[model samples]
Target: MTSLDDLPLRDDLRGLTPYGAPQAPLPVALNVNENTHPVPDDVAAQILDDVAAALREVNRYPDREFTRLREGFAAYLGHGLRPEQIWAGNGSNEVLQHVLQAFAGPGRTAFGFAPTYSMYPLLSQGTGARWIAGTRDDDFRITAEDAAAQVAVADPDVVFLCAPNNPTGTPLGLDVIEAVYEVARGVVIVDEAYQEFAPKAAPSALTLLEGRPRLAVSRTMSKAFAFAGARVGYLAADPVFIDALRLVRLPYHLSALTQAAATAALRNSATMLRMVDEIVVQRDRITAGLAELGYLPHESWSNFVLFGGVDDPRATWQALYDRGVLIRDVGIPGHLRVSAGTEAETTAFLDAMASVGSAA
Candidate 1:
């Protein structure tokens, strides 16, 4: 039998080993930063009823453009954005790919800071674009001057900013975002996957929306909104830029069920707000606990955090798993990222951490 192995792999992907098994379960699972709280029975019932009504929304297909969901999202964010300014995909991860495909490829460049989502450069390279990354200072924040210098040279076609950046959870300085937008000849995507946990004064690219046509903000319901299983993510960009996504992104990319469920959640933003408050409260508690054990996590505005040890992070991860607590090995060499869970589970995790640290 002939095999396709002879067929050449994509040139850019010839030699990279992807992260293995992101779903492997541990005794106290805290790896993915998923919302520890599931939708309550009331929310679940509403979701079911709304979905039943919306299932007949159109036998033909969902609004190929997802206009209502977009409008609802814009209103939910109170960003005054219109349907034309919005785009949705199965997840924010896909939206990241859409931006890279539309803006960066061939000889073009896509750039983001290192120790970020870790998915950005992978997506960029997949698009056949040259991917470049600059490291943040030890404090885990990137500055406007340093980022501006890279944009001046790389002149990236797409710049991904995971505000309150992943793993590190430190938001990029607002000035850095503005500088990238001001200088980049191409689009700048602000991946605000964890904005709810960020301080109110933390900088965001959303402020430059009107004057900066190339600016885009990608938001996910998976984090603060507690809609991970629903798999809904949206982008807020200039009307024209968001529309450009239509050219490359799949039509009806959002499911009727997902749209129904997510639309309902956003309609009742108060629930999400309440959940975020709980998660934030728990995050602080967990951070404080971790610190007490000499486990210093970088300042965070996200559901999870980054902490390092004097040893291999992967080993620390395996050690925790061996003890029945699952956490993330953030590929930071000697660091792991721990997400928040229920209060009881959090206590178990703290105990697990104490045991692991003591043993190490």
Candidate 2:
């Protein structure tokens, strides 16, 4: 039998693992920060109609520029954004990959605060760019001054800031984005995959794009719109910054059906996003419940909660899994992260935690 060792693989990727979370057919699954709510029936009907229409042109290549989809995203983002400022891919990971390919390659470097979205370093290395992991303040917070100093020292060709960071659920401030951009020489990416779940009045890095061509804010429909299965993610940036991505993307990268469905979803953005308000309710419920159970739950602007003080994360994870409830361990010592599911699913998770006892 052949194995990886017997094949000729790139030495840089020799020991690296592909990014993924655990998969299971659990009764209550809250891992991976997915929006567990199903797409609204009315919106789903519209998407079906659009996708069916698109199928008639399946034999032809999709719009290489994806113009209409770009326009849809620009309208949805709505901070005076225009189609010229938008770029998208099958998912936000691919969107970020384009940035890496355009700006950072072998000999150049990419930087992100430590314990960020696990995919940051992986995407950087996959592009042959060296990945520099910088330190974070206590509880995984990054201060503007500290972030700027670290970026200056690393001198990377790209920087990834996971707004409302994953695994820890720590929110990034606008000050940090401004500070990093002032000191960093490279393109700065703010991955706001969960931004729709943030407070309504919270400012986004998109607001910083007007004067900073080097800054980009990426978003995805997977979380708030319940369109993860549709594989649509986009970004808002300066027109010139968007042009850089054009140089690296393949011709007709997005499929006609994908563009159709995403555009339809965007048209119904108001209805689809109503789920976010409900999810936030469950998120706060989880936070309050975790604290009552004697666990320390981090304040989350996103749709998940990362709770600490678990004595044996693996054991507790197994216990919850045994009860048909699955959450993420996220490799943080004494910590676990769980997404905000529908009300009933959230109840099941909290009940499972209570029954399992606080291992701490």
Candidate 3:
């Protein structure tokens, strides 16, 4: 067999590991920050019908523009967005790739604060863009002034702001976004995959999109809509920005089935969102439970919680896994992340943590 070392590969990817979270089977799995709740029955049935209809037409190519899907997404967003301002791909990762391909490539650079979505750097690397890991405060918060300073220093071609950021679950304030935007010389991408799980008052960068052609806010149906299997993710941006993504996306990138399923899910957006409150409740429960167990839980506006104070994060993760519960270590030193699941699942996770003894 030819060893990988014997084959010619891109120099940048010769020794790189793929981006993925552990997918170990466990009785209570809270890793990956997936929406634990399955799609509701009624919505599932509707999606089934839509997808079946789409399958019949699979002999032909899917709508290249995904016009109806874009319209559905715009309607679901309801911020007076037009379909022309929307762009989507198989997932938010692909959507981000489109943006990076369009704006940050070759000699350009992409900058983001550390402890953010792990994929940002990887996406930049794939595009041959220099990835700059900027700094965040000790509490994982990025203040407006600090953000502005970093942007000024990096002067990157693309800036990524992960609101309700992964690993840390810290939501960025509008001030921080505005400050970064003011100093950024090129595109600013805001990843809002978990925005629906945030508090109602949490500011969306979409509100900041009126005149900022440089701004793009990406959203996903995977989290709050419980449609991860559909692989639908989108962004709201200026039409000019959206147009640039068209140049990078593959032809018929989204299959007919995917567009149909995601469109149906968006049409039933109200039903999909009904689960947010319950997930938020479970998230708070996990936070409080971790704190009571002597762990330091970070404030989270997303559907997951990141807590620290573990003497050995890997050991704690293993201990919980031993008891049939699974959560993410997130490579954050002493911290780990656990997504909010059903109430019963949350209880199981908490019980498992208690059995393992916290902060040890």
User: Estimated TM-score per prediction?
Assistant: 0.94, 0.99, 0.98
Candidates in descending TM-score order: 2, 3, 1
- Candidate 3, residues 285-349: lDDT per residue as tens digits? 99999999999999999999999998898889999889998899888888889999999999999
Q: How far does residue 110 in candidate 3 sit from its true spot (Å)?
A: 0.8
Residue-level lDDT of model 2, residues 273-343, one tens digit each, is: 89999999999999999999999998898989999999999999999999999999999888999999999
For model 2, the superposed segments whose C-alpha errors exceed 4 Å read none
Query: Which residue pairs show collisions in model 1?
Result: 164-171
In terms of lDDT, the poorest run of 10 residues in model 1 is: 18-27
